[model samples]
Target: MAMRVLETITNMTQLCQKIVHINIRWSVLNKVPFFRQSFRFLWDRILMCSVGKSIQYRRLHRCASSPSPAAIECKFASGDPTTTCTDYDKDSDLVALKISLLGDCQIGKTSFVIKYVGDEQEHRCLQTTGLNLMDKTLFIKGARIAFSIWDVGGDHRSLDHVPVACKDAEAILFMFDLTSRCTLNSIIGWHRQARKWNQMAIPIIIGTKFDDFVQLPLDMQWTIVSQARMYTKAMKATLFFSSATHNINVNKIFKFITAKLFNLPWTVERNLTIGEPIIDY
Candidate 1:
């Protein structure tokens, strides 16, 4: 009888393990990317309080009221699961800025974005397949603006599908390399395509590799800038000459975007735009 009882217990454990594996697989395929992260986070917390040392974690959390470093770290590392959801909650008016990059392949579009968010520029960037979506929240003045930037594929073959990914963007950043004439020429087509996605939105013309322009003929460089500025001005778009390698006015671009979109007073700096309006539209 004891042998039979032990056998039954073992079978139950095996069954539970199989069930857990199947559940994880389903979650990974159907749920958000952060679902696994959330599971791991909850599991870690549970383990810390149970099998692991509970008092140490409690002290760590107590040191920081509200969201502890541990919690913020988890959110940053895991990314907010809310952003991946297909539909956002309509009740809450959380302003979400959809930004996309438009330029030729290998034109430092991805590098530029990573530099803004990661604060570093490296040539080791792999081609973005389909789309790469990331979120960063900036606190300007007093409000918060959540930026959901999508780095779409810059491959020539991928141009047809690019507009679909850029739908509902609050702004589009058309990036071109200062040294690459091919990338610079592609900007016109990219801008036309992006306009189809969001007609009334703002477009920011960004000239990458601004540092390298000194090596090129000054007249040629100014002519390029003039052509870009003319196109942007015609479309009522903003233009900026920036080098991600130098981090010049990278902060200013985001801040100015906040001010333009939210129509906040220009005096406040480093302030996030508030999503909630006093009067509901």
Candidate 2:
């Protein structure tokens, strides 16, 4: 009986080896470019499986009524896996959000991001040459949210560069300074151009530096609010005002984004427990 079982196991191993060899040859026999494309397709399909760790919609909502984004775009350079996350398993939808801040130079776009990410105050306020990116893992209810936030230069000269920044975004946050009427006026043109380029559904209009003036005239504030509301309503977007310096309504902006992008309830404290420390899963 032992000899018979050993013979069966050896035969099975040999068969498996032959099958693998045949598959390798078959894969290589295809055109080299075709083989390369097929390999990439398979790799992306495998990564899509990780979406199981991401949000799983109970029901698909209409485009007009969907609370969260339909996809998420993770930022990963050619060889940098340290920053990008792949914790989700198969069958996950990738939500891609492209956000760009446009206003005159020194409108506090970088400051807003630093505050949102809770970066140190003295951290070098380096002018974003082209684009800067930061990732934040958000929790909407118990669901995991990974957002890639891109901070683009807001100078008018950068307007030509905006399309590249806003390309393929599921949502966008258009921010302008509360105190600068010129900055406020530019939003209309910017919004029109961005909509033409991206044609995205989810958008947010933000007024930054609310704490700059003790009290902005009611009419001035209302005018800015009305302008933003008009555009947001036209684009079907949410609107908000925030101060990154004082940390006022910063969480509110995040909550709005989480709710809009993931359709999940917002919470300040995260409840995720670290199991075994994964060196590299």
Candidate 3:
């Protein structure tokens, strides 16, 4: 906070100096004594106006009750379940990131969230009529990263919950059942609905039940993979073949999200093999 204030002050000071220098140069070039005399009065008013507006803007952001944006990021290592995901609900400094899960019913949308948030936190989930909300707080480095995950029911009634679930979300996960092609097709609709509420949230296409998906014939797997890749391309999203049951690519997905959000180095390589759990960006 101190550093930010100092930096803001230094930047405003330099900017004021530049503006004053430019105006003084203009007055001197024109060789007008009256303009020179007026420049001092104008300069005084300009500096006062600039400082007043800058202070006003800073005051607006200085609300003590509002949650601050996440600045301290901990190294989120992929494929390691122990890196984070603790129950840090009381931490006032915890930077909360909202994530919405959209998919068809029985397509493992809730299961996918449970897999990432863990079974212990499953009891903490707040389930209402159409929406399922769960929270997972991660202790990273010295800061807390909380994920407020909203899973909307796949039924038609859940459409009402989409707007609330997606509004101000940091990322939205579009899930599908790998064994069901119709479920995969519905993801585009879900994506459209989510975008209506938030166009800036990171879009991710997740194929659930990958374990069962691999049990199908090799040709079917190839077809499903190709279709998934095509949809991923169309949506301009990152695709991950996941299984809540087997826990494949479950933790890794959130790690990828955390790393991306904080601009951390992502060490996971892309995999396009049909039989393997694919991770494509």
Q: Which stretches of candidate 3 lie over 4 Å from their true place?
A: 1-92
Candidate that beats the other on lDDT, 2 or 3, i.e. the better one:
3
The Cα error of candidate 1 at residue 5, in Å, is 83
Give the CA lDDT, 0 to 100, for residue 237 in model 1: 70
Report the backbone clash tally of model 2. Answer: 19
Q: Look at candidate 2 and tell me the lDDT of residue 195.
A: 80
Model 1 residue 146 distance off true place after TM-score fit, in angstroms: 1.1
* Candidate 2 lDDT tens digits, 1-281: 99999999999999999999999988878668897898998886676566532223431222223333322112111122443343545313334344565555677877888776546322533345666776554333233346566677765667777777677665677777877877767777777877877875467767778786337776666666566567666756665666887876665566555555555433233211222100110
Query: Per-residue lDDT for 44 in model 3?
Result: 61
Looking at model 2, residue 27 earns an lDDT score of 81
Candidate closest to the true structure, highest TM-score = 3
TM-score: model 2 vs. ground truth: 0.57
Per-residue lDDT of model 1, residues 209-229, tens digit only:
766755787677767766766
In every candidate, how many clashes are there?
7, 19, 0
Checking candidate 3 for backbone clashes, the offending pairs are none
List where candidate 2 sits over 4 angstroms from the true fold.
1-98, 120-128, 139-143, 265-281
Off by over 4 Å in 1: 1-94, 119-128, 267-281
lDDT, residue 226, candidate 2: 60
